[model samples]
Target: MVTIKDVAKVTGVSPSTVSRVIADNPRISPATKKKVREAMEHLGYHTNIHARNLVAKSTKAIGVIMPSSADKALQNPFFPEVLRGIGSVIHERQYSLTLSSGETEQEILAEVQRMVYGSYVDGVILLYSRVDDPVMSFLQERDFPFVMVGKPFEKLQEITHVDNDNFTAGKQITNYLIASGHEKIAFIGGSKDLFVTRDRESGYQSALTDAGLPNNDAYKIHTEFLKSGGREAVERLLSLPVRPTAIVVTDDLMSLGVLSTLEESGVQVPRDISLVSFNNAYLSEITRPALTTVDIHIHELGAQSARALIERTVDKTVPSRRIIVPYNIIYRNSVSEQ
Candidate 1:
């Protein structure tokens, strides 16, 4: 095995310099670091990560905590896009990412405990935030370095997070429909346990209240974050004694489900009932009538979370912070005048 000492001897640099280069210590000048890396490559010297971690007391790896329903959650496609953004940053920083998730909250909690207690990761990136989440509580109690990808339900000052302004997003989309003469508009969202759902619901309600439009309980529905959930919501909405003129779905996958249900029922979208959704994901453009949805910059959400987590791992004293990515509504054929 070509050791660090051998590489240092070949490069005429000290062993300490070689170690610092491997650690990517910023104090080392760029040119010297390049030279050290080149010498290591020439000598076929590979640093044993385990041994280095043992000596440094750092794993050089991060844990990614997904939602409890991870298998179902990943079906939405937004998660993958967000991860691409995160991976772009961390991969170059010499940090590896490991994922932990489960079908239930307790299962997810168990996975997180193992990762945190086993010293398997230096930090964690949480993919979702929910009300009274045990995983969040556990990380907080342990003073672990972690970053959330969504707004927390509370604790405005302590947790570091990256998210879009969901409240304004919901209000803006609702106001758009109202401007288009959609008075009997409806809202469909994920479980109320999620802060994303709560924020968006508040925005929607605020928009309706400002416009003097009726915010009826009959028009608001909550269900799973899945296609079937969207379909069920549409069914319930259409069956109401007073049908809505338009609908605001919280997710693109749910919107896709809504479109499918409408097509099967011979209900022409935009013509029959204008529709809008969030997370302008891949399917938004290809739907029979491209969805006029909100693009919350999912990629930036991921990239920024990774950046924030990396910042946390480097300095514990850095005050916890918040990063809000921008959002926009893309006009497509799915939404039309009432």
Candidate 2:
């Protein structure tokens, strides 16, 4: 058992100095930290994370709550990319990540409660935002440290969150379709309860209003963020008396389903119908006649949320922040000049 005292003696530093180095305390000078770390490594001394956490009153773990079950969310590439980003930061900071596994809202809430009450995590990162979410309310009531990856339903200025300007992105993408001569444009979005869908849909409506285009309620379809949702949405669009020539899908995964369904229906993309989507996920490029989409920087959204949550856990006095990541349009082969 290589103890802190043994490493301290070997490095000619006090045991307390060695402990500070292990804790990564900023008060320890860089040179001393390096020396103590080297000596600890040479002596094969590994700090007991559990013991350290007990003393520091920190689990050094972060909880990530998904909008849906892990099985469903993982189907979308966005979630995986975001997790990768979050993991990168957590790994660097020597923290662990605990993902919520519950499949329903109630179950998820229970999982969150367990994480908080059981001291399983130092903070939490919410992967989605909804109106009057119980999870959000519970965290607020407890004054627990948490950060959301999307805009809050209310208290826009108070809740710490990391998100893209979804409304602007939506308007810009729709405007692109309009500029390319698309008058009858359709929108396919995820659940209406989600803040992302509402914001983007509002932007789409705003763009239509600005262009003096008809805003047909029938043209807007809301479904899950999965491929089947896109497929179902396309069925509705095709059955309409006046089918749209361009569609702005809120998710790339759903767009894939739209593309497949359209192909099966003999609707030539861009010739009969142009398709654009959000999230420049890898699959967007591989699809035949690749999709024109918005790059929302999903990874950055996750990384920033984790960073903010960690900051909050460290210093609760820090003011809440709204971090908005930028978006860019990836003009691919999916859109055509109508």
Candidate 3:
């Protein structure tokens, strides 16, 4: 039953001053703001966010649109870690997170539109970046505030995105395979349309070329970056006349699938075929061989994305930013000398 009016009366300040204090407005003097805050705490004053947002024209809620049908969002180690970072920063800032997923592009766009124009969220953070995605276009056309988690193929200078040097990560893994004495190496990747896929593939190709190795199309495979996809890619690679001695999988989940198929096919890991994967998911560590993979700092990626989105939302005058988190290679039992 405690209200702003009660706190204002106790603190000898107007209700509007109490409101500004609650919002941590810099215009309010620190001493007055501290007094108002203490009065609010003493009176157990709770804010009516709906009414407040209506007055301020902001929901203080950020909409997060992830690939709903990916099914792998929860199963994928990278996403959960990134989410943790996002959640931590949002919570600390006293903001709310609204998660949305859709089966189709139209559905996702509809959800985003609803979140924005419907006044459900002040801004949005896209979890995936693709070439000319409708959702990205919609936000850009209207000049709505948003941030993407991956780089976009087009309009690199126009939009804000948070990502790591995926090209370098891919090349590093490929170089590791080559250093291990594996002349024939294969690749299992996610969707070809994805920017991450292209960046990684480019890295893989660059490493092969630099090492004076032939880049065989037969050794390259494109999959959904899931366990089943990895399994299928491995099956196809094994059926080839010249099988690869090692493989670089773009996702840890797919790597697990490849390992499962390899085990069933009586291929001893590192002894018969070495493997390297990305994301450094928990599954990587739990695998029989404890996969050697790249750590993309998933949590930090999420946190940074949230921060970028928040900054964009709050300060419209700030220029678009492209932030690159760091990555490292974690050596483990999944890779061995040829």
Candidate 4:
């Protein structure tokens, strides 16, 4: 119930000065700002966020629109790590985080519209990037500021995004499999429309070609980045007349599914088939054979996204909008010299 008026009275500053101090306006003299802050802390005065937002025309809140599939968001360690990174930066700036999940494109778009138009958030961070996404298009059309965690296939020049070089990560994994003496390698990846999948697939093909190995379409399977999808892709690959000696899965969760199916089939890992995966999630380390994976720095990715969004919200003139995090490969027991 403590209001800015009480802080102003205690600090002997005008209500407007107290308000400016609360807003962290640079115009307020440092002495006045310090006194106002001390009074606020002493009196336990918290500004009404809604009222402050209305007065300043900024929410000091950021909207994070994640995939509608709750299971995907919960099961994947990458998302949590990314969120952690974002939270770290946002908390430092005293900004609140609001998360919204949508199952369909339409639902997501509607939610985004509401957030942008209703002044619920100053900006948004989208976790997934698809080719020609309606959400991206809508935001772009209105000139609403937003950032994507993954790169979109189109509009590479138009929007700000943060992502690791997925194509390089894919190629590196593929090369690791090849160096282990595996010629027949299969790919189990995420949705085809997603830019991550496209980039990784390109990397896979590039690695094969560079190594003088034929890029066989039969060995490639595009599925959801889930355990079920991984299991199905592995099963299909195993059923092929020319089975793959190794597999490069785009997601760690999907790699777990591949492992499960392989174990159920009585196939020994690394001895019979080697595997590599992305994300380097905890599941990779705990599996029967610790998975070899590419560490895409998920937490750092999230943190960077948050920082970028905050910067855009604070100052529209800050340059160097696009940020690309780096990736590293973790060699594990899942792969051996074949």
Q: Highest lDDT: give the candidate number.
A: 2
Estimate candidate 3's alpha-carbon lDDT, on a 0 to 1 scale. 0.85
**Candidate 1 regions off by >4 Å?**
1-54
Ranking by TM-score: 2, 1, 3, 4
Off by over 4 Å in 3: 1-54, 70-72
Higher-lDDT candidate of 1 and 2: 2
What local lDDT score does residue 313 receive in model 1, on the 0 to 100 scale? 66
In TM-score terms, candidate 4 sits at: 0.84
TM-score of each: 0.85, 0.86, 0.84, 0.84
TM-score, predicted candidate 1 vs. hidden true structure? 0.85
What lDDT tens digits, residue by residue, belong to model 2 across residues 1-338? 67777888899987767766764644579999999988877877755545545676898899999989999899999999999889988887888999988888899999999999999999999999998799999999999999999999998887999999999999999999999999999999999999999999999999999999997999999999999999999999999999999999999999999999999999999899999999999999999999899999988888888777776775566678889999999999999999
For all predictions, the C-alpha RMSD in Å is 5.8, 5.9, 6.2, 6.5
Q: Write the per-residue lDDT of candidate 3 for residues 1-338, one digit (tens) a residue.
A: 67678888999998767766664544579999889988877777645444545666887889988865446466676777878999988998778998876768888899999987898887898888877699999998989989889897799999889998999999988998999899999989988878898899999999999999997999999987678999999999999998899999999999999999999999999899999999988888999999999999888889888887776665565567789999999999998899
Per-residue lDDT of candidate 1, residues 286-335 (tens digit):
99899999999998898888877876665565568889999999999987
Steric clash pairs (candidate 2): none
- Tell me the lDDT of candidate 4: 0.84
For all candidates, what are the clash counts?
0, 0, 0, 2
